[model samples]
Target: MTTVLIVASNVPAQPAVLTEALERFKGRGARVAVACFFDAAELEIDPALAEIRSFAVPKEQIDKRLRTALGRAPANRKIWLHAQRSGWLMKWARTADLLVAIDPRSVHTVWEMAQRNVAASACYGLVPALRALDAGVSAPVTTRLERQVSATAARGVRGARRAAISSAKTTLRKATGQKVMGTPAGAWLWTRAVSAPKIPDRYRSKLAARVHDSAVRAGRHAEAARAATAAVSRITNAATRAELLTKAAQSELAVGRVPERLHDAISAQLTLADSLLRKDRKRAATALSNAWSLASNRVLHFDRLSSPLVDDPAGYLAPFRASEAARLLSAPRGRSVPAAPVPSGRPLRILLATLINDNFLHEIRQRYEAMPNVEVRFLDLDDDPARRSLARSGSSVIEHKLAGHTPYGEKIEEWLRPHLDWADTVFIDWCQATAALFTMPDPGDTRIVIRLHSFEAFNFWPHLVDFSRVDDVVFVSDHLRDLSTAVLPQLLGAEAPRLWVIDNAMDLQRYARPKPAQARFNLGMVGVGSVAKDPRWTIEVLRHLRRQDERYQLLLIGSDLNAKTSVAAKQYADLLKRDLAELEPSGAVQRRGQTDDVPAALAEVGVIVSSSVRESFHCGLVEGAASGAVPVVRDWPYFAGGAHGARTLFPADWVVDSPAQAAERILAATATEEDWRRSGQAAAEHTLKTWDWTVTQTAFDRLFLTD
Candidate 1:
């Protein structure tokens, strides 16, 4: 009997196709063994027909550190690494006459298996598997040495390619790493080298990224930017140009700075997107998706100190907004029926949904969950692998939006329609993928409300949300609402949902704690993981204050910034670390690690500083104020001169323009214990009255309780 092995990374979408193909293999007198990453029990195939087994490594079983290290490897390499760890797969892969991959994700596994078992026929899909079996029947028998020789020859060829690439990279890095590149002449020479003749496209791109990275490390941002622009301009292939420009742009973002050539990078992607649209809409959507991904990357636009989009939203995104394909994706699809009012005699079923970041929902969920008249269910879209994959399927989402029909659209309906059916009202937090997916399908009578926090305004997700289908679109602040509406034109349309500004829910009553007299000398900043938080500015404030009063010190609360999040983050973190090393030993600055009790942490903090370059709302400063700390809010630069800003959001006395002003205010506010305590009392009363859950919940209740 012939032996066959099949590997599937996910459950087959159409099991009938797989079952029919299996029946064909069995009719040919083959014994089959199936291995899948998902549970075998989910499959309906007869056990007597084939021996099925699961190759899934449970979450607990996976070494997270190892998985993270393997994450950077090629998809095929990662698949092989995981599969090789399974003894059952190794055994079957070696002896099988044929190997099959049920899905695209599994194709890598079969590809690796093919390399190992050269004698066996390997292919993807049912029809290809069937054909492989026939080819195997007529294949000439191979000796063990022949198989080994072929495998060794393949390895030699792959090794040679890898070695050649490695050598080229090493050579390029050395030539570009010279200090001479700091000057214009040197930069021009290196730029020419990158654009030199006989250089392969792959090598040239890699060289550009490496040179830009090295130049940035050498602190030559302008030089690096110029070199990348020159090299990209020399490239003829639009896709390759897009890739190189994107990589260069990402390098700048990695260090917490905007790319000097961000406009060029974005334009290249839009150009490519438009090019692809003429030939294939799906491909065009994917290109637009790539462009959006680069433009909306959190490190560059949201998590950083500033953004080009915030500077000029329409101008920054002019290329994308001009693209016909991007417009199609943003085109509003109105819901068929208006949301039905909450039934008077029955409990209202409300579903609170999000992909991740449920920090804002705790109070709202607790309130609804405790209410007798309301039943609440929370759906975290990222909590499930299936939904998570769907949420991240940017290309598929674009295709669905452009075509008005796709497998992805069907899947979204199948997965989310049940929740829509059950809930009288659906509140989606964060106008990201969850909001887009929820709004993709028509809501028959269910109310759809999506809340856009600060970050989503800077991302492509808000553009993807079909505002016409939404009943209420909420923002945390007027500034964020203005910014979001400015970028997403759909929100401005007459058919758009009712816009509302709802402050984030916070239980500030708990933060009303007394502080020690010495607390007046301490300045505290909560949450400093992103470069935008501008913790360095707080340090500058500390330095400025300490010169006058040595008693002044800064308390940096929350986890240290994670450099691995982006190249920009890593660069910022490095600079911060060096600065911290100098001040930490002298007690001028202290890193108070993350904690659950912000009130307790703030009790020792007399002055709470909002040194962020930008914010929708400085919740941390408010929390600190609620804890009896004097508030010192920086005039967030992004929105400083705009229609709405930190100045408009907070009392004028609390907002400062510069570090010197912040230091001046800090000194004046805490000049005496009485003045400090009095200022703290006033700020605390303001936050409690304006933003506390006690105050905000009423607005929330009106949103849900009112028809």
Candidate 2:
């Protein structure tokens, strides 16, 4: 009997595809074993057909520091690193007659398996596997021991060569990773290597990025910046220079430090954009789009505690404003036809769209779906794998906008034009890629309304969005509106859309569950997914409260922070893990990881804390408040002292400046069960009356209902 091992990076979207393939294999007298990166339990199959195993490496098992360090490696390499450790996979791979990769992500695993099991036929996808089986090769006479010996010999030779190369690289990398990079000798050596004659542009850029990452890690920012400039200067092509510079900037930003050459990278792209504008408009738009992408990277702005763009919007984006190509990109590409009037004859067709975050859209969708006068369709841009790629970058859309043609444009037209024709209004939830893609082609009488929450104002996405094509721009808060308009010049222009500050739709009624008297001393925080959430600040508050009364314990709800998102996130998570280690063991903090029933969880808490450094809207805090949890909100620093801030958004009593102040507020409010209940009841009433879906749905109706 023929033996087959099929490795899947993820569960197949259609399991029947795999099941059918398995049946065909079984009919051919093949015994199939399926190894997947996901859980075996999640995939239901006929037990007699195939043996299944999971090779999923739990997030907690992977060393985050190592993962962060390998951030620049190819996706395949990342997958290989995790899967290679599974002994079951090794044994199955060695014994199989044929190895199949169910998806692209599993191809590398199969490739590696092919190297070890030289006798096995490795192929990707079911069709390829079937073809390989049809075009059968003679079975190898080599025994398992002989194959292992041959594989070992091959690996040994390759290993020797790799080790020599690795040794040299390690020596160089270590030097850069230390304070040595700051020294004249280290700088001289790097300068020589980067500027070495006959070195290919690709090699030079690779060397520069490596050295840059190392230097940045070592805190030698100036040296890293110098190395990047010197390396890019050696590369003659403008595109190559811009690409290298952008990578360098991204590398720095990933680690939570703003590169000194970030402005230089943006300037390089602007120069390239201008050069391409006269010769090739599409390439120019792409260059400008890339510049905008770099300038607005979340790592540089929103994901961090501070943003240069937020500090001085006009100043930070001044380079783009000065560039002709950039100006062309942002220039009004007005709609071919005015937005169609909301038909009195039929229900108003509205499409609600967002990339990934749909937390705030639940209520809007429900309200509109329930409305007799409205017809709603929800489209998550990230839902479709094909559209997700298009929504990832603005270059393709910009190319289409400038040249009037692109594959992305055609695909978008084919995919979205149907929805555009059906809907009288498209309410895109974020001023990001989804907004940019939907607005790439003229709306043709379909009103485009995009909501800017918080992060988009700090990123390049809003710049890509055609404000002129949009009928209305919505903001969750006045502060977000002010910040967005200040950053995006098009929003300030005459053709700018009607700006509206509409609070996010939320159902607060479910959060009104009664709490026990002991809940008065229980503090809670709902989300801690980002560094901007500043969970450490919440910990400090808990620490302060614990000094007064150890009965005050923190209930941390929601998923743990994702350390893999960025270097900053990793560092923050490390700190949080350390804090949790101390508090959790002592029973001072309870980490009730992600749960579907948030309202039920909130019932255990008396106080809710919003410890974010920046927030357009603290939804978690609001939800908690609506759950009869007294809110102690840190005056969100991004807009704290601005014209509008958390202080203005919430009641003056609800907002505080520091952990000490937050702790003080919590203590005072929860001094007695009566006081705690009263405080929570008042806060709940305020959120329900002001920000709840019942109150906000009318504003949404007006936004769509208006001509």
Candidate 3:
């Protein structure tokens, strides 16, 4: 049998290539053996080739002297050292008729083995080894001598060149070290070098990043920002300039601080997006997506008490307004025909569509399904994997809109066009990815209605939606409508869809259960899982209440905040843990995490609080109110002073401006059991009459049933 040996210093880049080469060798009647430097389990070779022997080097068995040398050596030289000490590998190499190195790291080891075993034919790759075998000859004597002479000459030149490069790298590392970068003179010298005229863009960007990172580590953040700014200013290419600034911004965000050049980075990316909009839409979409990610980072918005989006909506979004690429995304793509009135001839076909969130749709879906005059089909893209992937691809949607058509656009048509043809109207929840995707293909005469909740107004998805394809846009509260319109001016344009403020449909009657007199001392909050919920605000109110009456306790109902969501989230979560540590053990605060039966959980709550920084309608608070819990709402900061906000949405006395005000209201409402019961009863009656499904369903009917 002809023995063939293969050496791999690392896992094969393409395992299938090695597997196929092995099969071909076995078919030609050669016995195969593999020497793996890495763990054998990492190689996913076919188990059918069980007869092939695999020899793996044990890392622990190597001597200390050899291990120390291996650390400083190149990967190719390290493999040679490992092979020299492995007895099994040496035996296999000596016996093999054909030797092959599967990757560059193993080449040096194979070359040394070939010299020791001159009878064997040596090759650097599978194809070369196969060619050697096909030729039916080991290398000619003259060719082997010439190869040895050439290798000796090349080694001398390589050794000298490597020495020079190593010396230069060592000097450069010292010059940019933390001790040097901490000094102003060092920072100035590097900044000037990076921004020097005629420096290649690729090299300048890379050097700037290295210098900035070193300076930041040395506590010279201002100098790092200057270096990046100077480097970016000198970059002639818009894309490169955007990319370097974006990297600098991301590095700061990764460390949980807002970038100093955040707006500059966003503006640079928008400029690049605009320049590439017509010629290279895929690239433009990537640039725009990067800009959006930087602008809407959680550290700047959700984790903090105030957000730029709420503080200055127009100023925060000015870059997007100036970009032609963003304009194209928002540009009206009018439907061919206005939706026909709900057909009188047959039952009205209503399709309810969303990506994954169906929490808000249960009431509306059940209402329509029971109607004798309506036919209902609910489509959640998540139900089908193929459709789900297409729905979630926001970049592809942006590209398709800019290009006017793509294979992705065709797939969307294939997936949703049939449903559009069948339905009289489609009500899509959350003006997010699903809304943008459904609007990709013209809805023909099928009415498109999208509901904009609170979160979408702060993100990029609302811009991606084709509003002209929609017949009506629904908002759960007037405050949400105001914010959405301010963020997206397309809503007020000539081709904009009809905007309506419809209260979310909720079943309030189920929560109107009797509460025990002891419940008068219990304060409750339903949803505290997100940063926006501001559970810490409720904790502060609990602190105030407890100082006056030690009997007062707080109940938090929902999942704990997820720290893994972002660095900002982790910071907030860590602080929340400190608060819980002091209150949780003393019976002052309790957690009744995520329960399906909200009504049962609310039976112990005497006062319900909405401490969120923002909300579309604060559904949980309203639900608690429906259960006879007196509502204490913090004027949602995102829309506190707006024309139509929590103040206008709820009764005048229900909204409070601060934690102290909320504590005062809660104390007044729960002073006496009789007084608390009376207050809760009035709140319950108002919510049931104003916000219940029975009352809101008529507005939906007018939207769908009427033209």
Judged by lDDT relative to the true structure, which candidate is superior, 1 or 3?
3
lDDT of each: 0.85, 0.83, 0.86
List clash counts for every candidate, in order: 4, 0, 0
Where model 2 places Cα greater than 4 Å from the true spot, the runs are 1-184, 188-211, 229-240, 280-286, 381-389
List model 3 lDDT by residue over 548-587, tens digit each: 9999999999888877877777888889999999999998
Error of 3 at 401 (Å): 1.4
Ranking the candidates on lDDT from highest down gives 3, 1, 2
Candidate 1, residue 619: Cα displacement in angstroms equals: 1.6
| Cα-based lDDT at residue 628, candidate 1 | 86
Query: Which candidate's lDDT is highest?
Result: 3
Candidate 3 stretches greater than 4 Å from native: 6-30, 34-96, 100-131, 134-136, 140-142, 149-198, 213-221
Q: How accurate is candidate 3 locally (lDDT)?
A: 0.86
Off by over 4 Å in 1: 1-190, 193-235, 251-257
In candidate 2, the residue pairs with backbone N, CA or C atoms under 3 Å apart (3 or more residues apart, or in different chains) clash, namely: none
Candidate 1 vs 2: which has more lDDT:
1
Residue pairs clashing, model 1: 254-567, 254-568, 255-568, 256-568
